[model samples]
Target: MRKIFTLLTIATALLMAQCNQPEQKVDVSPISDATVKKVTAELVKQHGDSQKERIERGVAQVAMLWRITDGTETDFEQFCTTQFVSDDAALEQLFNKLSYGFEMLNGYFILLSKELMKPLHLDWGPVTPIDELFGSYNAAAHLNDDLYANKIAFITALNFPYYTLKEKTEMGENWSRKQWAYARMGDMFTSRVPAQLIQNFSTVNTNADTYISEYNIYMGNLVDDKGQTMFPADMKLISHWGLRDELKSHYANKEDGLAHQQMIYQVMKRIIDQSIPQQVINSNEYKWNPYTNTLTKEGNEVQATPEPNTRYQHVINQFKALKAIDEYTLKMPNYIQRKFEGEFELPVDEVEQLFIDLVSSKEVREAGKLISQRLGRPLQPFDIWYDGFKARSGIPAEKLDGITTKRFRDAKAFEAELPNILTSLGWSKEKAKFIADRVKVEASRGAGHAWGAEMHNDVALLRTRVPASGMNYKGFNIAMHEFGHNVEQTITLHDVDYYIMHGVPNTAFTEALAFVFQKRDLDVLGMKEVNPDKEYLETLDNLWSCYEIMGVSLVDINLWKWLYNNPNATADEVRNATLTIARDIWNKYYADVFGSTDEPILAIYSHMIDNPLYLSAYPIGHLIDFQLEKQFRGRSFAAEVERIYSQGRLIPQLWLKKGVGEPLSVTPILEASAVAVQKLSEKK
Candidate 1:
């Protein structure tokens, strides 16, 4: 019921004893099988052959879910007999009413949820545990109970019996918009998870989010083996994002750039291993020597405790919470199946194969060779984040920061500049104004995010880390990414014909657009790429990016697989397992080129803690972005984007085919990347 435009996260556990638990599937129908069959036949006999198919399906569907408290067998029979609409006009009318009703219900709950999360998400004052408690409180947690109690869920389910993802994909090819909407309506009540369990999931996830959001590292306090401080005294970077971006920015530093990158890599390793001192996390109180693993105060060595595996502990908490949901999801029995087929509209194996294919291809080796030649050195583990291809990479960080801070002194300034940013990307003035009017800008608490509106009139949120001083270059680039999400959100919601088909298939689709916009950040600043082979360079950049994150995603996937297998694993066990998994993936795909066989640098992605299994979306989004960019050749960028997104929520394959005339495969970029590598190498 709650519409969360968040970083994608959801999942849980096992096969042998999966359905054996006594309490599992306790919500079985109290109505007898004989009664259900008899009622179905009677409803069919009354409705005649033309209406017989729907009558039987609807009656049986309702009877199968009827409980003792809901009604007796006789009441179930009577309700089905009276409620079944045989006429086409009548059915359409009923469908319209139900659709409108649900939109109102789901939309307003989303609005409420946004307000509740504002304090935690926004830069509010020091949040108390009570604020976190309220933030976790999902108002729609019990909305399912209310719907079932009032028989709304039963009625909807009866009319539109649930279709599996396979069924939807196959049969949906011929179905009209109304039919697809009805199928989704059927999806509303496939299984009844208890309200308390939903609340539990919400609470667990919220706490994990709070943890990751506050996980900051004081970069200024870090020292090398020789007791040298290399960073600005006031520099503070949050886990993964700030640290990674800082590493990227140093590419222009030339002077001691490698040293800075190595230091950041060491810092990431400490974070991944949970050996970073507890006192140093999110604090500037202590000086740290990451290479030596020491903490000190005022030049005096001090005893500092490690983080005690809180990083992995939160993951286990999420795992256990998600595992508790296994029995409740009957169709897609396990978390993996549900996450891929149900939500992503793709299979896990399929997505994994796509990732694996690209990572293992000849294109990757060629790209790596090109990168190493450009760097004039052997590749390091941290080279996975090579950022030299972009147009702005040559520009000084201070120069970019000066421009960004001067232009966007505050959130309000950025808000006012949205229309211009939009127009810079080929959007007409009227269209730009329309989108900007519905986009709200705000200071974010974490590495920012975009929160889309639920209802038509509500404004979409663009949250970014605008410091008290001003927005920096990193913050500006991220803001552009979030702005892409806001644009997609506004378009899909306000322009789509059906509320049920309002968004793109999943978060990955939005991520694709965000990547697209992010690629154009410099263009928005009137800093066009001067390099002749910019497109080819951009292609290589995306390939390297995909190669890096795909390995990280493999680690995340395999880590969860390990957690499920070792259900009773302790925090320390998972921590050790995580490092092993990360190293294993790195060794398999990245070791030969990087000259490092067991580097756990990939495990440093913060998404693993707060947004499980979501790292895949980024790489997959990059793939889609490349393919879409290919199709967008010679087309008006703004016009085509509106056209593509306006196609609305369809299954991934179908959406890709309609949007780009090809199914989602990495071949486009892989093939193009090979050509790019050859071209750039020939020039050199």
Candidate 2:
């Protein structure tokens, strides 16, 4: 699946700035409680008693954001008295003006950032240091500062007063589309993080992203204990995504599948423990035996340096940068809170509990046993990525690669066929053309991502690595997934009712749609599932996928918690803690299923290194995808997706409930998987 760069990505970038800086005393509000009371009372008197709640909330919100530099108490009072729009028509007009202005500002800023990062993101050339610097330069870093300086931010905050997640959940059910738009407007300018801090965080984050992007393993150079190469001579796979996908593909290769999986498992362990030789990463100069951690050049053993714990150092740098912004964020004082409550609009405890419940379920063990029986062997640690349930697992990887490479000779070929891809999935030709026209495909420098456009006129960029030889099956599958994101991005932005409400509930929701589109990749290629028990097998696939990712997500969550507790710890300490956490989580949830303990394979996800706290979305997306698949069972797939996502940017549970008529839960998948396991077991 692809990383989604939406409005929240920009928000997070700006919010998580400022590295190693002491907390500045920015909490002292210039607008006093007395002034707030006086302003509220005066506004109520002027606008009438019926507007009391709006007056009070608006005044309080303005006061929360008002600094000494903003103005004096008297000036604050005058501004509120003069600017508070109590008339319904006038307030609506004000909202429209702000919404239009903000869309232009935000959309252009997003465009600028995307353009600046193109050299780093696209398959252009070798990324120079200058390219990295430009990628890290946030054009809108001072957007908040500028808005506040000109009082536009204060005006928006006052009129559309920020609401808590509790408030939204409790009241959003009764809200009109316009009310939801107003609430979204209130979401802007909630923090006053400085531009320098934002730039610093961007630099740190860009560096980490570059590290992960380039950390490819030359698989062809990997040697077994007997000095045998098991892969194609030209094959190189990036960490986690490329490696994991390569491992998953071997499920179709019965000849040497087990040995291949074991070698990849060892490679992952070395990476997690920082024992991977430095010369082997992104270079094929030496033939390295992953099993023995030895590098050999031209039949001679060569001394090699370990990676020096650079992975954990990046983690620590990100932590410190995010921690520096905690003081500026008054309501959600930490990065964790900001990420969950402020961004996801779901609490940390709730998400964690959801993951724990699913991982601990009995369905997982039954599914694992079923997989073991199919494989004719006891489960290995890498079997967490068990791909046997999918129909593709029965098809040879080479065949699929040949089909994809021939069909999509380049990025442009795929781009041109997108409309056909959409129409094959049940969209009308006109509708398909409408969506495909707004999405541009690009060959990626790293594992691809979907970069959504903030403005309606702009196009969403679907980036995936298409080798010079052509687009392979893995790249094609990923392109399909990214196409899902682009379709959603285009729909939510152009078809939604309000500018502020121009996205799904969160990244998880987008991931769900991506999964939906991904499952239909073979269908798009005119291949149908011939298996009589297709639905049951698919259910099992969803279950096993969630089982694997949920454990990884737990590691990401707990690792962040450990970082908070040990802020002063060294990279080596962080590395030790991460391995221990990965092992503990593995023992708790995966050991019984896979019959393996202390497996740090769960920590091998590139997302944990480059995109912090993002792993949870994949599993949650699986749950949502199951529900959406159920919804589309009898209905038109394209129509159902359009209907669901058009109701944009609601809270997750509310969005799920409205779209599929149930809240986000694992029960649907678990119950279905149980039946699937029983039926499949009977078939065998």
Candidate 3:
């Protein structure tokens, strides 16, 4: 907590620095309505100056205000919007000034983190300065960008808690600064895992090229909430391709990238810090602790905490427990699972082969053919799912939607059924009653997905923002998905230690937990009963979904690289690059099924423009969900479900390891799909 506070102090200092310097000669008196007119006139004269000059003058003008803080915001707003200075560029510059200040504050908060652990007794090496670690440079050295570059520079210029204002304002770098650099570096490199990948890191794991494609498809879909394509035919050239060769030099190595990643996570973490449980702090006992850490609170003897590097290992252990279920999913396959109409079973080996065949099936091949002809590019296997998935589960997809709409449209209707849903899953009446009481569902017209926001208090909020258009099958599924998130949210946060951490490890980790429910959602709706045949279909769906997103993520990674490399690329060029990426992924992965010359479906994804570097989670979630499901299969559903969800938020990988007895891996995807395919084939 002390460390976190220190980090926050630095951020505070950055925000404070945004004001006029104390050394400047200026009045401190509050400005009145009359003064606004006078100052507005002077600012108008300065408006014609260069951007820097305008900023300097504004700073000096602000210096004169003695106790002027009261109405300064209003006065400034009035002045800016007055007839005297309405230049768009001028307003933009002002925005830049304000934004720079905001970014500094954002960065400062980001530097603070609860994840820090006690250093290992073993000394490693000399601490590095923050500037050197992150390649800090003076204003002269920083490159100019529309936004990010400026924000980064302003943040770096601020002082840390250990340093006084004078020392912080010093122009030159120092040894202390270097230490900050090293810690920041360490934080970045170690955020998730060293091996944990970025968007375009590799094809074997969650590939970037595939992700980008999927992003585009989702983004495209989001354009028209009414299930209409928002993209124009001619504007399809902005897609991301493998621009790694271009982006590699800029970022250099893992350290640089990790630093940025950590920065984003840290900043967002701070903004939402209030929402996080206090029990997560490095403390022995406190009320409001999450349930998972209660064991520690109940005991007086404190277990020795692991050293920093190894500390993550405990979290990893937890991650394994959560992820152990991935292995079980790998046994289910797609083809045989889909082929079975009702009760059926097949040898696991047969399921695996059938899964492979389904991935390369003729229908999947045809989907590629359709996409390639439409987009004028070769098809990829990843592109198959967004299309094939729709094609395969046509009626079921619609039916699921109908189920959600019927249940969700009337909040009370769903609430009444929730108790049954929970109890049927084996929850005791008391436990079921508790959940039923806390759950609150809301829906609104929106393009983004539903989310469960856990508040600081005992109460939890499960809100879904639906597109303004009427709810559809897709909307229903998304709603159900969010419902799963809310369920995990309630169990983990409400039941955990009030002071201890109570939440999923990361967005992906939570997604994994929510998916467990989503997979079972069909059962909840009685759409896909847990009969042998339905289980087989579910397995097939999982494999297809995972395989498709792997390709989509690939595209997403490449597109970012493209943007990084060709910063000046026209929309058309970006679109062309996207087309090329789609073709490349499709040809390589789907050529066997769809033919070597077919086009890819990446063009249809809606996420490309809306969310960046986010498509990979679907596959990862699938891989994790199946594994977690296996652990609870034979157990008393409610007891095991509560125990698992009760773990709340731990470092994702570490949490799984502890809970599931294994490391995070993709075996679950391979095994489950294979088994489902074999089973479905036998049914036919």
Candidate 4:
């Protein structure tokens, strides 16, 4: 055996949910052990000891997933003997081939899914029942099973033994780009889950996404107890991003600001409590004042029913479907481990701690005090979203909307200026055009998202809500954010060294760049902020907004923990628990700052209902955004963006260290924020 048993054990212990349980060693039949030993001996004799450790680990890892149905022990030995590449050049060649093959298989399937879900994703009239079915369908569900059956999967796994997250983090720094690519290749075939369970997981998540996408609150239909309307008659806001942004916009509202803010706040509470009239969800049949929980249509007050725990139903359904996958992923045994350690490459505990450090910081109380002083009033629960840092927040909301609507007019009009938008951010025209040409913009059914191409030739899709009238200020801002993602996607995909490594480490890194672009939305529109204290305000903005999202993310994490502990929790049980968790987080971190206790405002994120465990990215992204912003202060924005993003999919800490000067930490942001608070306080 090779002298690296420790790494092999670590590599094999890639359990999701951080299951500390011992990995069940593959109980190979005696014949199997004999065959593996025989193969390793011969391969060592042929390849020499330099390749000994890798050969021993690779052969055993592949054999671990092998079954009697995959053929007799003799067949396994024969396959290994035939497949094992002793020559270094040949093995490298095989890895490259596998990488390209995977790109094709994964890429085309993703594109197909994107096309099939177009009806559900795009604002193409109305979504049909069949569209939901198609959208929920996992087009690539059988790809894994088929690959396993065909032995291609076994071959890939044999050549490229999967490295565990720990092993990757430990050894990845010393690895060459190709070696890292090979390790990522090893990640391809770690599980042998049935296709049906995967389809169920897909269906549950798809349903949740659909539920959230259609969950529009008719803001215009929202009325106060005194029967006054504040929003535009045609305005329908999606919960809770649209509603949240709309609430943020009210900071600029001189006359009706506080009332609109209060109204939106009430609306959020109703949704969270499931007390919002069911009729007002995605319908214009009635006007409702969320404050009194009252419903009316035209001149007549109407009867109403509450939304029957559908939100929590989605959460529990996702919990059930994903939990079923736990038994199959014996290495990473649960969804929590799979999501954080596997997908995000972030440990749940570490992510949670980072969040708590920010939310529970003295900086948050200082930020709240700053907002209070500025508003000349005490903090409201909704003031967690204080949006005064951005240049547009100082401009009248209507004026900014006018400027954006005039500039964009429609999705195509915005699409036409993609290059100009990039150039405005200091990119050279050539580079801007290169990226813009490969990005396609479209109107979306939901708030919006950036969908990157899995294959290089494919264009990145930027989807954002463009109302029938025009692209409003909110839409433009989101589009700019998505555009940032698209740029990252294109650069990391088209310009990086390896197809397998062609993306940021995780969504947060992309989001960091997106936030960077989003902050410059005013600059892109020729409305730059001239405030000398703007940078300090921006730091406070980053910290405070991060504080708000951190609370929500803590709720998300705790809710998952609750689900895992109580696997059979009913929808109502999950609902009640979610509220309790939200309030607990709020009280722990936010009560003193916001002067509220048991506030369920933390439960208002739509991501919790649909995105499951994804809320953590926003806060982490904000931190990354702030740190990356620090990097660009004395540097060229365009150059650093290209250089930083082109590094492509290293682990988070490694990527941060290489991109910025430090690892992913709150110390920089917290320190800067303390100074910012002092400076701002002195100015006041």
Candidate 5:
């Protein structure tokens, strides 16, 4: 078998080289038992090492592939081919191992770095998942600067930076929307953050969730007022999952908990099957050619048909109209454009008119000056929406006095009654204690916080640290969010293959898990029952915010594609392009109902600076949350919740498939949006 393997490898290599020459076919034979055993052993042995070593080795190996000098595509591919020929199996194994091991190590390092910085008393916090996301683009931003300068020749050879931006712009103009969507997704996956470090210190974790709880309570006492919480009463702070009840009741079939699985499956099926088509339709990849009665694209020419009567179609039409306006606005005078920028120093009448033209509600415009005076910004049209969104939706800030005191006191009371809470959620006494023992709480001021997990043998740590924090509804909501993360992490990390598939697929997936848990925070707070009223309100909020942000993601992606396409575009041009995309998206998605026009607030998402392409995750995760929440409605949380989280590190598609018997997709969000719209319309 070993001999046959060698001959087959040689034949395949020879056939590739002989592509222009006469091709000679060779018979291939099966491998022997000894060879198979050796390969299997190698695979098993390669994956068991510490994550740190694996990362260092992988970096060193990739570094060896291309010279720092610029090289052509032919040169780079040739180098890759040569390297592959020498030890293909070894290379493949190393690549797979590094992919899994290093990313988790990245998480571990974040914990270590934070722990190290605290000793020096520097303003060092663990590198958040957010930081990692933004950091992914560091190499690209600095590619022409220091980081990739030394490798420019090599990069240019493969048309690295050149082709990257070129493709984005070219595709933006000509690619089919479906093709563009897939390509953009590929770009996203490839741009995963590189593992860099803050010295050798890194980040570490264990039991800090308890400490955070106490701290939040302490802080809330000092900073917040007595009447209402300063924090927004958003979806992250409320909702309940219904997994366990479905498992127990006859609502779903139960053979080895098949009912719970079916619930998840139904949700997954709804999301994936529906979302793809909608996204494709919304993506402006192809240009309509009326002359040919078709949609003309760069790669393919096709017959055109009327769009379906779908929400996505409306979104597309809105964007197309907005895009036209944006194109014209870019050529407008600076004074006109600056008025649209966050440079509002215009007269009161003008400012008010801009607000009227731009904001969803009049209250938002009134809230703007208050926000601007506090933030020390000259009120701009773009500032009206966000400040107003917060002001209009959030709990008042003055009502939060003594909220922290209540949190600790409440936590203590709740701690004593946690067993009952668990029982209510359908847990046996043994199961309840098993979960409660894993939890540890710390009292302080500010807000409650949770750490993922730290385990020593059978005793795992689930911590809630609310230091100087408040327990107002909003504060309680955040605490609930942290708690959700801790619960999901503890269950998934401990129960899964600890060394390999230890965590969920990406930050977005885990974010979805936390979102699912957050829905139940109100129940934990003993405020509301998990009934349809609460559920309907939460769902409406989700759709409202998600619909808003989807347009924001569109602005971000289009702006990036625009800027990258135009290499010579100045910072001014980039900014203008961004504003254009922002206004276009907002007008298309929201202008009619908001009773507003000519706004660019959506483009100003801080996420654009901190983490590009990340704004989409919020809306996407919210969508997933809605679907999963539906699955868990009226279900037993105690029995099925942990099991769901424990299926860690599976690809998003595979994870959903395993948990819910369907691939990951966007149908869930769209369907939820339609339902939310219908419900909301009825309310009006």
Candidate 6:
């Protein structure tokens, strides 16, 4: 669905004996305040007052990380005095060397990781235990510790130092590209989580990912009360992406659409509350009736067990793993802080408020009413996924599938056409070929994702579920989204001037570009929309999308908050809390619009279980997508994307301002959606 940011690989941990043990605090800095002050004074005297700020920040940073094993106070002082550089030319040379070394180190590590994860991620043979073991091994787990032991980390820290989010925001306006790269280099050694902990996190995260990747529901086996199968006999779908997309697809069917949607909605509820039969998940031996929550085998009802809160257990396991690392972090002591302030570079309160404003807006309610009118029936809770605003909703699923399957028969076929796809989006032939040659498409075992390269010499990967028969329309759409991520990844890494600034501000920005590409899927297929009211419909569609995902994101954010507040909670407790949070969010934001309350459908996103607190990025991405779309109006799409993305890794607001001429806010989408609703209502 979205590109997985691999930087937080250390945040995930295994549910083993080490995870069960009490957290051992790692706050063992031996350098005292006097030592830090003495080092700073000595460096400033040697370097001059012109380098005062750098010297002071550098010394303090090194002092904070120096441990008893690292050396005594004299060693720390000596290290800082000897390593600190005041000359501009020498410093630039040092920065270049460090950047080159880090790029090699990180790039190879990523390559190794991708290779190890192949059996688990790719649609190869069945994954064996050895495959899982290899996947869990973090090749670069000890790299940070190794750097510290060799005093390279100290050297980097002494020169570059660390900048708070506040400092970056306040000073970034006047900062040159080199200054920003220096700031990012400063970010490399902020914390020193143990290598063992890092390895453990990797193992647990891989396990969780494997769990999600294999969680497929045999949709064809699901029967109605009358024992009639609604889906094709071989129709298997992964939870929640596959199931959710299938539900969205049903909106095009006027006759059986409602029944199919209701069935999918029931399945979603069962998944959320953990009431679905254990036998029905990833198995087709039993004929399951989701509506009645019954399973019949050989025309006889058989006993079945509910999933034993396995979903919630994964969440608890992740919480414990991340919580174990809490005491080790310095500036951001907890996962929540690290996620929002450290990673997102945005505050949680601000994100929550953004979602609340959009979901509670008059425009959302008006759009909901319009969706209800278009359906010619009362809106169901599942209507959160209304797809009629897009042109595809009016096209038959079989026709679209036939077109895609013929064009993209397999992964190689899709790979061969990447250049064509890029050219259709307005890139020059040479530029399109350059990008396409650097992107490799492969068949995925799970819902697809884009993995960008860390080195310019490497290629970005686009993975989607390409069936043996052919690539379906859904697969093509997901491939397009991931191709967007690859394009951004390639541009930022290969086009940007600095090695350190080779990515977007956060995963949300990548998701934004993915959304942009996804919206143009039909156009890329040479089936461009000829509707006169296209822009208005798109606005409504964007608004409704934000409305759906914002609530789900709130559930994810609030659930993490709950886990943090109640650290001793069990799996069942977490499950109950999640349901309550989901229901509360649904009642507050979605109930009035859909004529329903206490619906747990918002919690059906798989990200909550595997990727913690990642759901918020989608709604934020939608907002960004809308802004970027506005910027692309009557402009060369490829040129704007390349130029904007090449501005890599600035703080979110500054990046948005530079790209779209306005800071990030919901105002643009809200105002546009309000006008769209009014105009569409007049026509009705």
Using lDDT as the yardstick, the better of models 1 and 2 is 2
Per-model TM-score, in order, reads: 0.95, 0.99, 0.45, 0.95, 0.46, 0.98
Deviation from truth (RMSD, Å), model 3: 26.7
The sequence of per-residue lDDT tens digits that candidate 1 reaches over residues 1-684 is: 012353211111111012112254457787787887887788778878877766666776676667787888888888887877777888778777887787676668777877888888887977789889998887776766677789887788777766777877788778787777677666666666666666766788888888988888888899988888999887778888889999999888777899999999998998999998899999998889998889889999999898999999889877877777677666666766667777787888998998899889889998898999988888999999999888888899999999999999989999999999999999999999999999999998877888887677788988888987799999999899999999999999888777767788877888889999999999988888888899899999999999998998899888888988998899999999999999888888888878879899989998899766777778878889998899888999999999899867777888888799998998889889989999999998
Residue-wise lDDT of candidate 3 within 1-684, one digit each (tens)? 000111122221211111111222322335555655555455556664533333333332332322343246565445333423235565435434543453344333322211111011001222234412221111211111212222332222211112222232242133332333322211111001111111111111112212222221111111121223232222111122111111211122233432322222221222111222333222224221111212133323234332232211222222222122222112221212211210011222332333344444543344344445533445432334333222223343335446566665644455567777777667788888887676755442122233332333333334333333334445444455666666676776577542124455434555766666655555666654435465555555566565565666566656555554554455445556766876786676655654545354544343443333345455556656766776776777677667766665443444566566554556665565566555554554
lDDT of 2 by residue, 476-545 (tens): 9999999999999999998899988988888899999999889898998778788889999999999999
Question: Candidate 6: worst 10 consecutive residues by lDDT?
Answer: 9-18
**Whole-structure CA lDDT of model 4:** 0.82
> Which residue pairs clash in candidate 6?
12-201, 13-201
Clashes of 1: 0
Q: Give me the displacement of residue 327 in model 6, in angstroms.
A: 0.9
Task: Report how far off residue 294 is in candidate 2 (Å).
Answer: 0.5
Error of 1 at 649 (Å): 1.3
Candidate 3: misplaced stretches above 4 Å?
1-383, 386-408, 415-417, 458-474, 498-500, 527-530, 596-598
Candidate 6 has what TM-score? 0.98
Give the winner by TM-score.
Answer: 2
Clashes of 5: 93
lDDT of each residue in 1-684, candidate 6, tens digit only = 969665533222111112333556666888889878887888788889999999999888888888888988988878887888888999999999999988888888888999999999997888899999999888888777788999988899889978999999999989999999999888877777777777776777778888889988998898998999989988889999999999999999988989999999999999999999888888889999998899999999999799999999999887777777766675777788788788889988999999999999998998989998999999999899999999999998999999999999999999999999999999999999999999999999999899988887889999999988799999999999999999999999999999888798988999999999999999999999999889999999999999999999999999999998999898889999999999999999889998878899999999998888888889999999999999999999999999999999999999999999998899999999988988888999
Q: What is the C-alpha RMSD of each candidate to the true structure, in Å?
A: 3.2, 1.2, 26.7, 5.3, 22.2, 2.0
- Candidate 3, poorest ten consecutive residues by summed lDDT: 189-198
- List model 4 lDDT by residue over 159-277, tens digit each: 88778889988999899988888887788678766555556666777788889889998888888878888888899899999999999998988777988899899999999989888
